[model samples]
Target: MSRKAYSFVRGFSAQPARDLCVDRHYLLCASTGALRLAAADRVWLLPPARAALIEAGHPVRVDLPQPATTASVLFDTAFTTPPPAPLTVFDLSPLARALLAECGQWGASEEPLTAYAETLFAALAAVTWRLAEQPSPVVLPAGRSPLLRHALRFTGERLGGEIRFEEVAAEVGLAPRSLARRFATETGMTWRATLRRMRVLRAIEELSAADTPVTTIAHRVGYTSLSAFNAAFQELTGRTPTEYRASFRP
Candidate 1:
């Protein structure tokens, strides 16, 4: 019989510009770099400490701002049920990491999986589905409307510096109050909350992709005080900037 699951490692020099969909369930995590995954409703930053599980046929845009190596596994539907969410970004457990490390040696083969390999894959899938129940807070919601999209784009561009709701509203041609309502309506987050999330998301990308110092990264993402940055980062990610960056070490 054909293999029910396989794993592969891929490297990207630049971010892919298009969305991708696949027929098999996918577990994607960065082994030596970082990943940014954007789905319909949410965007995720995956460093070595986190993973994104995508259900078969779900379209997602993957961004690798830095040259990165990704170790991922693909499972045939016959081997496991669909995940609870269409796409779930969650913390990667030690067991899941160990399983992926072992399975990754196969390197995307079509040959039949041995019984031991089958069992290992099954265990990994089980752990994945369970972990999906607890999604990570390190995600930002995406916006759909044109005005909201414009506002989001502006915020992303300005994340490295201070951003105010009034500035964004004026830039997007909406009143401050009106823009706040739009943000809550479309993304289900207040303008302040969204900005905080956006800043931390950018910090995660930097933390994962470079050797920049924590204080520098904190300021780069618009925080004036290092203590304030640590509080916000830990509130969203449960890890300080230094600790989070250390996770990427081999």
Candidate 2:
């Protein structure tokens, strides 16, 4: 297995645009603007004080939503353990950022730089683990009714299985019609839209661990047809399943 690790900084240019084809998992922290990951029309926003854990082989179109400075560290599977996923958004601590900066300056020197880089890597790993141990803060959109919380929580917990709007409504003690209206009003997305997000997140998690067949992943996330699963995955990730897997391999 080929193992490589390095650290660097990125300053966004005017009209920034780059689609990175990563061969290893990458940890990135932004100092300004926002980092957006697009899969078709869907976008995940990353702002400063946060880090984005992009999985190996995931073809991501990245752009600075505004002028920004980003510091990043890349590590292959040999150098770092694969993170638990849908891609992780971690709250970056000041100490962690400073350590990363110092590591970047070391530039592969053999003695002191090697020692410092090792220590920095250890700290980074510890910080990432601590963040993962914390619970996710669910952010409900304004105008969303309290009733929708139960349905959302249920979907999140059962993302590995098939979900239907009727089932979600029944679980919440509402008719499908009423539930649909309320869900749209409160969440600003239909139940189907929410399900898609959940499924995509699940797929990302699986992809990070190992190269499982896309069909298996699609089924695990509740798609009955492989073609449909591929379509959905590409529509959201802007890359085919094979392309995503290839990015992580050495």
Candidate 3:
């Protein structure tokens, strides 16, 4: 499997932290249950109807729960250019999901398997194009407010350190009340909510690397205590830090 130019994995089980040193891009689509894919800078929360695109040689660790079904394919870079980013979590419609499953089921000698891989790759490329033309299913708001923009730049620069809201407002020549109101009005989320989201997203990226412990991640992301970070993480993503990091463990 390690030396093969193409591979397909379909099963009803879980996978521990592992790395494949192949020059083939990997596409994973989940049909039922849930799986977590952990990479260097991102932890993908993959559920039904979601797909993850990973670049060739970019290591990922997979963890799955019981009653789970997923189809993954490894193909040459000729199929599609490397993803523009390190990680992209996009919606996968049912029809495309079935197509992916069908692609995963092809079994034959290496001679045929390699050719069949091209057909599968083409289909996936076409499917990806169609999905891109449609609106993104997952929309995290990034509003345009000059003051808010300045405030964001100011806040973002000091993510792991202290974030004094009043000081931020004062520097920008706006009252704290006005800053909160304008931020909520423009971003559709309160200042605190935005801050939490930013921290959590950054935390997710850091967690995938396995370089940091859960306790340090909480503090690194500005959580005063581990318990507080756990509650906030679960409240937003339905998973705790330990559980999320477990998906990346060997």
Candidate 4:
């Protein structure tokens, strides 16, 4: 309908790098699988139980490693106030999910919305803003400096193996202490914490596949001990791997 608010749905089965920037506020959720969104200074792991609110005109890179069904709504700037952050990933409650599903019925129409449709969108917008108050921890901060960026890249590429701060620093041509300082300054997280966050986020990507075993996912993310993997995952996400996966189950 009119640009006040409109719904869009899509299914993605393969990995594709999509760089997106639109003039309308984007509320995106994956009803079936997971989505990885990378902005300039942050990365968010959006699971089925979560949704990300992207401010209008903010560019982001989207990645879908597994098959996923996405239900998204774009709101005209005049229709609602902006969220506090440029991008926010938050837990999606049942009511919010229902609202999104119902709104999907008005998918990307060119005509004006009926009065009833307008009311429905207004309610959905209220619920979305309220739920966005408590942001989720399934996000990682990105570094700005080239050295720090290189270090992050190195750590990400070697997530399946043991990653040491010293090793990363050496690869990036910096001392361990200096690199640690850079990480804290640029990413607002200590090197060890950043590494742990990376592993956990990567594990989430693997967990998105329904057929993958938890033990396999743990090892794939560089955890030699399943117990440690479970504890780390729970500490960051507040849910065990199995519990998180169960959220996607019908």
**lDDT of the candidates, in the order given:** 0.85, 0.64, 0.64, 0.86
Output the worst ten-in-a-row residue range by lDDT, candidate 2.
135-144
- Which sections of candidate 1 miss by over 4 Å? none
- Which tens-of-lDDT digit does each residue in 108-186 have in candidate 4? 7678888888888889889988888888898988778788888988999999997778899889898898888898899
| Model 2, runs deviating above 4 Å | 1-3, 14-18, 39-42, 108-113, 132-250
* Residue pairs in collision within model 1: none
RMSD of each: 1.4, 15.7, 10.4, 1.6
Q: What tens digits encode model 3's per-residue C-alpha lDDT throughout 51-167?
A: 776677877766553345666766667656666554456667656666676665654235544566566657775685466454322223444767777787677677788888998
Model 2 lDDT tens row, 216-240: 8988888888888788767765667
Model with the higher TM-score, candidate 1 or 3 = 1
How close to the true structure is residue 31 of candidate 4, measured as C-alpha lDDT?
Answer: 75
What candidate 3 gets wrong by more than 4 Å, as runs, is: 1-88, 91-115, 122-140, 248-250
Candidate 3 lDDT (Cα, 0 to 1): 0.64
Selected candidate, larger TM-score, 2 vs 4? 4
Q: RMSD in Å for candidate 1, one decimal?
A: 1.4
Highest TM-score scorer: 1
Q: How are the candidates ranked when ordered by TM-score, highest leading? A: 1, 4, 3, 2
- TM-score per candidate, chains pooled: 0.95, 0.49, 0.51, 0.94
Taking the tens digit of each residue's C-alpha lDDT, what string does model 1 give over 44-120?
A: 87776678899999999988777788888989999999998988788888898888888876656658888999899
Tell me which of candidates 1 and 2 scores higher on TM-score. 1
Using lDDT, give the best candidate's number.
Answer: 4
